[model samples]
Target: MLEASLKTQMQSYMERISQPIEITANLDSGAKSQELRELLQEIAAMSDRITLVEGSDDAQRKPSFTIARTGTDISVTFAGIPMGHEFTSLVLALLQVGGHPIKLDEAVIEQIRNLDGDYNFETYFSLSCQNCPDVVQALNVMSIINPRIRHVAIDGALYQSEVDERQIMSVPTIYLNGEKFGQGRSSVEEILAQLDSGAGARKAEALNAKEPFDVLIVGGGPAGAAAAVYAARKGIRTGVVAERFGGQVLDTMAIENFISVKETEGPRFAAALEEHVKAYDVDIMNVQRATKLVTGGNLVEVQLESGATLKGKTVILATGARWREINVPGEQEYRNAGVAYCPHCDGPLFKGKRVAVIGGGNSGVEAAIDLAGVVAHVTLIEFGDELRADAVLQRKLRSLPNVDIIVSAQTTEIHGDGKKVNGLSYTDRKSGESRKVELEGVFIQIGLVPNTEWLKDTVSLTRYGEIEVDAKGQTSIPGVFAAGDVTTVPYKQIIIACGDGAKAALGAFDHLIRSSVDMPAEAETATA
Candidate 1:
């Protein structure tokens, strides 16, 4: 299952195992079981400290395996092959179970170990999903930390019966104690917040006690990371507070357009951005969303959703953007239950099933083209008279036999059977006729909406909600700056965002220098 180069890397990684570990395989006479057996054998051969044993047939899922420390109940189970995005999760589980120290913050680790009550978690994931590994790896770490917590990462494709029973139409759907917990990507902090009610309050209290920063960035995408690095290098206190640190970039799949880097994945690129910022003196606060911004005095105040307020001399807004949803009936109800935004992440879940792609831009055309290879058929609906995608992409999409294109069609309502999507309704602009199409999934690929709604009244924003900025990346507000997709910059790309972010940081520094020299002595003293 693993290549020669991958095997060499896995072998080297296994050398960090300082304790004996056992892999108990629960298998039956099945093709997947045999594949799992071979993969387990290959893994076991990489390290002498590891051993593989056959488990009894009493297990609930065949072709599953558990990794556990020799004499400890601390273990995590995998019901399907943990390759693709989950390969990192498998490696982390192996090393963590075999006595390799976890790299999480000490406070987080302690909190997990101290949690009370017994809990069981089952995470349903697809191999192609870019967001599943984080959820799986987080639950795996928690299970290993606290014996009272047990988790199993199940592959949705391998357990189609269970998926149908649960009405799971999305990847990385998590269930706790046999009840639905959440859907989509999740972080360790987010999971803990849901489990422990007091975690948020405690976190807010700690954040409230932090000192004011010279430069505070309100996002963690490429733009935010670049701003943080530039500000931190100026020997000033810099802080980055973000809802997810990686923002929309984490949801992106391929990033071949990023300059200097030939090709990379979103998660990997986000990790590199974090690592680069960490090399500086930037204080990163992850999983924190800013709700409001106040500016008048020397320090600008940013309010968080957690009831915490952060103060800074200068604020850089790089909150980025999110996928624009076609808000219609049943769309929200069937979200992740059949209506998804990411084709690369959730397309595999609809294999051999008919699906539809909304919008006719590059993203939509690309999605339709990609889904044609995996799904039975694809219908591309465009509100415009013609597709806005590049000529090459439109040509490729037209060549796909399983794909159909509809122009001047507006999505009206998504139809679902309470649990999963079955079809959708649309309107023909030219004929003014209503139409319906039967499909198992709907992929929304209509552009993006800037994450600047909170700043609508605070700063000058375009009708579309993007922050308006000058050449120096300065907003209408004197001391406030904005960059990336949140700003008025054209061509919302990663490289452009980085350059804009750097410019914003430099503009803030220039403002600070001029303000200090121009202010009255007494006023400056009072503000300071």
Candidate 2:
């Protein structure tokens, strides 16, 4: 008799709890409420997959529940509020609950699963940083690979509670097990090391070991050096990195105009800027490349090509575009000897010597004009019948005394005497004529190719492979930013690239500041 009574009471409770209640927006009334009621009725009748729950005192509050079956296990949860980055997290959570093993090497998994102690990681970041997406994705991937790794993305603007509690002043601030790790940018290897070493306690000493900088520019071109000067004058950390410490500017032969500096050589100008930046104690990393970006909850990660990773709150991507090659024979063998790309860098080296400028576009014509001023003679070769450059440029080229236009001509081979270029072979499309021109140098001004392939899966790109950025240089993915010739912006110039780099850096700073203030109070209040 007792069992029967208990069963009856359970049945009654289920009936009352399962009854669907009406849902109305706070502002909804009369017709709107009726429409919502109809919608709910239709939804309830469509499938038995969901169970409707009614709140105790709110007749207008109804939350739907879905019972999901994976293999032999079943789980239940509310179906609303799953979207955006949260949706990605939800899917991952579901997969984990469904017993789907994370796709990671056994060694990595074992190492992560063995972590039995509590860990707290914080990454600081701003939304305007173009390089942050790479770090964020890497962190998310690591988190998904290890269940014991509880990762949280705190907005520097929205999460004041956590920021205040952690005393975070930068975006991408990461803490492991309630202790502070290094800040700024980092890499996966660096992050793993920090977690394994119990919150980068050793790194704290190393951080103080280095001299304080006002601005540290990673590249030494116009962009990097300019940013360094600006930040240094403004009293910020300043530094720079480049292969030869001058970036692409060192390769140029001459600079006709660069604000106040008139008729200067590329290497000389770049050297001057390098000296200026170095005079202010700006750190420099010549011949270095940033290989990876890593982030924890609030800490940014940067990995170098040499396998070193650094931590910083803000980063500026001044990695300029590389010159595209013609891929003709003997081209690589005599790059600096006879074949060249930047006329402004190599033109003066061929003074009073025969030189050929390939292509018919603006760059090619401009290069031809510049070369005519120094070289004994300039041959402008174009594959098309007519020049593709502006009429003004064509007129200038035609009026030059030492310039010769060779239309319907294509370079077949670059002939060199093993050590340097002696001449080149070409084919005439009009008469099917093959000819060789003795020249001291060949300047290739076809165009430029941006280095954006690394960002393909992370952000949207245009047909030309440039990163698509909005007016403020924000990429499609939040926290990732891009600028300069790599973006869809018009004009690829030194001044423009420098301006873009500054904008990106400032944007990253803004995002970090905003996120620090916008985090949930509960998360902020939680003790380390």
Report backbone clashes per prediction: 0, 81
lDDT of each: 0.91, 0.57
TM-scores of the candidates in the order shown: 0.96, 0.49
**True-vs-predicted CA distance for residue 353, candidate 2, Å:** 5.0
True-structure lDDT of candidate 2: 0.57
Model 2 lDDT per residue over 371-398, tens place:
8987899999998999999999999999
Once superposed on the true structure, which residue ranges of model 1 sit more than 4 Å away at CA? 517-528
Compared to the true structure, candidate 2 yields what TM-score? 0.49
